[model samples]
Target: MSESIGPVLRVIGCAEADLPAGPARQVAELEAAVWPGSSPGHDPALTPRTMLLVDGAGTVAAALSLLYKPVPLAGRTYRAAGLSSVVARPELRGRGLGGRLVAAARAELAADPAVDLALFSCDRPLAAFYEAAGFEVLPGTVLVGGTPEEPLATDHPGFDKVVLAAFFTDGPGRDRAAFTGVRVPLHPGDTDRLW
Candidate 1:
């Protein structure tokens, strides 16, 4: 799906596997630039879908990936999609492009009936940035990643993380209390741990 945000700017969405070579390379480069030392591609096992904000010149101005799966939380399962690898071109920071892209992604998830909620962890300082895009901090909540035997948590030492979520389904919204003040096991496996 693609939407025209302006005459010279547009936002497009596609499964990561279906992304063309040029745009995929651009997304990978943006990811590596923003997050040094990390692999420059999406984890196919995570069922990632790419969202890109492209300029008139076909340059990827901002990008983020959405990963979908069933997440167990508070003794129940919820269809969840997480926001990952959110980044913008280095020269484009502070221009609100990232935030706009985030908000657009949130809206896209909200429209998907299959998604019960959107949940992910962000660095403490970026909480406010995500909050402005319609995500609420799930206080005292920690997401446990990796396998159950080898887990990584947001609350681990040296990590300043905050769990943020947007409940899309009525049931999940009403059951919000079950999410807060608890540790939710995501177990997305070793690759892309803590996404």
Candidate 2:
């Protein structure tokens, strides 16, 4: 890989039938490093499409997944593209590779006419990182993940979370003040913690 500024970036769709095994395996390795164990769906990258930052030699430097699902909000269902499983190689931490990849995901979502907004949650310490990448911290927003049988909301006791969001289209995001100081339901389902 180059020691220069940027690394190769690619956005892969879940239905990418031709994704080569090499990159796929590299993605799996990167995911495993961050998620050492298994869960319902394990990782969002394992579901919909993915965005990857591959080194010059084709090794995954940082990665995240873009999964879209309809969530009932404000008495309407909105098409949201949620970012999940974002990770950067441990050795490359301070290089801003993760930020670059995050920014790329935002750009992709912002440009998509079909996408309503870009939403996700991160720990309080990481809130600044996502904000630098253009995601606004939703003051009191809570994303609900988990199965319908046992739902999990970010605002639940003993859990500290910060919702990072970017409103792209006209409907839901038109009123910016609404998102602040209010709790909103994302409802990504039980398969993912907070896709």
Best by lDDT: 1
Clashes of each: 0, 3
lDDT of 1 by residue, 80-167 (tens): 8999899999998998889989999999999999999899999999999999999999999999997899999999999999999998
Model 1 misplaced regions, further than 4 Å: none
Q: How does model 2 fare in lDDT? A: 0.72
Query: What is model 1's C-alpha RMSD?
Result: 1.2
Candidate 1 residue 107 Cα shift, in angstroms, is 0.5
Ten contiguous residues with the weakest lDDT in model 1: 170-179
TM-score of 2: 0.84
The total of clashing pairs for model 2 equals: 3
Report lDDT per candidate. 0.89, 0.72
Model 2 C-alpha lDDT per residue in residues 14-110, reported as the tens digit of each score: 4323346777777777777777864313344334666677756778788777787776666566678888888898888998888988887888788
Q: Positional deviation of 5 in candidate 1, in angstroms? A: 1.9
Per-candidate RMSD vs. true structure? 1.2, 3.7
